[model samples]
Target: MNNVALITGASRGIGHHLARHFYDLGYTLILIARHAPALEAFAATRDPARITTLAVDLSNTATAEPLLRQVLSDHARIDVLVNAAGIFRPGSTQTPVDDFSTLLATNVTAIHLLCQLCTPWLLKSAQGRIFNLASISGVQPFGSIASYAASKHALVGYSRSIARELGAQGIKVTTLCPDVVNTDMAEGSGLAADEMLSTEDICRAVDFVMSLSPAAIVEQLTIGRQPRPRQPR
Candidate 1:
């Protein structure tokens, strides 16, 4: 049987790319995203039998949780889980309370709930792997994106703690903390495409993580771009 991979944020960005990668590798996919058109379009190009697309807004866990449960009911096991659905709110300490709440809801709470819900099914797989896409902000505080940073920090902390707990049960949990990637999110943050890491760089990190043996687990993989050289005056 083909291993099952449940990937959130499947409409675009890193998640979308990874979904394509896994699909090409013969893994059954359960793709979740907020936009149905993109998901449907992607699904249309592939074998419909192997793909399941769910358009869900992760910021609303109450609505998304049950929908996820219903979808997982038909799948026998989940071999790979990529929690890549996230939202960014650019602001400092003076950021609106609502922005902070939304960031935490989508970036932290929703992933926590997903890890909880998928643990059982993951345990059933021979090579269960959970990949949580965090950000450089998770480790280093960035200016003007305080709420986003805080939420990622929370996610990083939670994922690390669970890595210890889940490792004992033979599940490998990897937290990917990549610097700005060339995605819509990064573009919206005023980062030029040249200044950010490519989606392929992030995907390479995942490739490395997935290649490791069962005995070896990658707790965290951080990928950053090299600084451009200073031009002489």
Candidate 2:
């Protein structure tokens, strides 16, 4: 049987690119997103037998676990679990409490819960891997996105701790921290999409991590965009 990879946020952006990349690598895909139509559309483009689509709002933590259990029940093992679903709200300390809560639920809580739920299937794989898509904001404070930063920071810490705890079980967990990717989230933050990293860049990073030998592991990786050339005077 082909290895199975479950990717959240597979509707677009980095998650979408990663899904395509993994498909090319011959892995069966479980694509999850909040939009059912989009997920189904993407899956339709692929061999239906090799792809599964699940429309889920990970932020709705109340229903996430049961939903995930139902979807995962059919698969005998999950070789890769990519927690790439997240939301970003740009704001300072003045950001509303509700916004902060929403960000936390999607960005941090969902990843944590998914990891817990998928651990058993992961453990069954010979080379199980977990990739949590965090942000450079996890490492440095950005005043405009305080709440988003806080959630990513929490993710980074949690990923590292789990990596250590699960290493003995042969499951590797890696936190991917990238700075200003060319995505809707980064564009919403007022960054120039042309000047930022591409989804391919992030996907390449994931490929590298996943390609490592079973004995080797990258606990955390931070990726940044290349500097743009200065305009001539």
Candidate 3:
């Protein structure tokens, strides 16, 4: 059987692009998104036999595991798990409690839940991989996006801890921290389209990580644009 890849946030942006990339690489894909119709709509473009789509609200942490279990019924093993589903709310520490809760639930909690759920299946595969999409904010806090940054920082820490925990089992965990990819999420973040990295850049980084031998492990990979030349004002 082809290697199985389970990806969350598969309906659009980075997730959507990764889904397509993996499909091209001949991996069987289990795509999950919040909306069934949108998820299925993308799945329709791929070979039906190799694709499985599920609608899951990552923010609903309590229900995620059960929903994931239900969908994995067909696949005996998951070679890769990509935690790409995330929420970004712009605000400082003063951001409302509800927004903070929502960001934490979706960004950090859901990733933790899915990692636990997929560990067994991943262990069964010879080349197991887990890729977590974090951000530059994960490593350094920004005043404007305090809550979002906090959650991402948590994710980065969690991912590194698990990388050490699962390393002996031969499962590689990598957290990708990119600076503003040109996705819908970054549209209004006060950055021009040309300034952000493309989805292709993200996929290429993933490909590089996957290409390494089991002996090599990358705990975190940070991708960012080079500093633009300062226009003399």
Candidate 4:
């Protein structure tokens, strides 16, 4: 049987590209996102038998368990799980409490819940891989995106802790920290698109991680662009 991969945020950005990459590698796919129509549309472009789409807001704790249970019921096993659904907002110390709460809910809490719910299915697979989409901000402080950075940092810590706990079970958990990608989220951060990494670049990293042998594991993979030459003064 083909390996099965369930990717959150599969409707767009890095997750969308990863979906295509995995499909090209012949894996059965379960695409999840908040937008049902968009997920359905993307899945329609692929072989219907190999693709499944679920419209879910991962941040909704109450719905996440039921949704994951349904996925396990429909598919025999899930070899890979990608937690790529995230949100970012420009903020400073003075940012509203609600803004910070929203970021934590979507970026950190949702990832935690999904990992908890999916661990069992992942353990059942012979070669299970869990990829959490973190950001460089998770490792470094970014004043402009304070809340986002904090949430990502939390995700990074959680990922590493779980990796250690699950390693014995043959489940490889990796936290992917990319500096800046040319996605809607990056564009919203007011960064120059030309200087950011492409979605394909991120997907390539995913491909590499997924290709590793069962005995090998990458706990953290950080990808960044080269520094541009300084302009003559």
Global lDDT of each candidate: 0.92, 0.91, 0.91, 0.88
Q: Tell me model 2's lDDT, rounded to 2 decimals.
A: 0.91
Better of 2 and 3 by TM-score: 3
Q: For residues 180-213, could you state the per-residue lDDT of candidate 1 as single tens digits?
A: 8988877665666788899888778988988877
Give the runs in model 3 whose Cα sits over 4 Å from its true position. Answer: none
For 1-233, candidate 2 gives per-residue lDDT tens digits of 99999999999888989999999999999999998988988888889999999898998878878989998998999999999999988787998999999999999999998999999999999999999999999999888789889999999999999999988898999999999988877765566767888999988899898777767899999997787789999
User: What TM-score, over all chains together, does every model reach?
Assistant: 0.97, 0.96, 0.97, 0.95
For candidate 3, report its TM-score: 0.97
Candidate 4 deviant stretches above 4 angstroms? 188-190
Give the count of colliding residue pairs in each prediction. 0, 0, 0, 0
lDDT, candidate 4, 12-83, per-residue tens: 888888888889989999998998988888877879999988898888879876987787788888899999
Q: What is the C-alpha RMSD of each candidate to the true structure, in Å?
A: 1.0, 1.3, 1.0, 1.3
Residue pairs that clash (backbone atoms under 3 angstroms), model 1:
none
Model 4 residue 128 CA deviation in Å: 0.3
Candidate 2: misplaced stretches above 4 Å? Answer: 229-233
Instruction: Estimate candidate 4's alpha-carbon lDDT, on a 0 to 1 scale.
Output: 0.88
Which TM-score value belongs to model 2? 0.96
Worst 10 residues of 3 by lDDT: 58-67
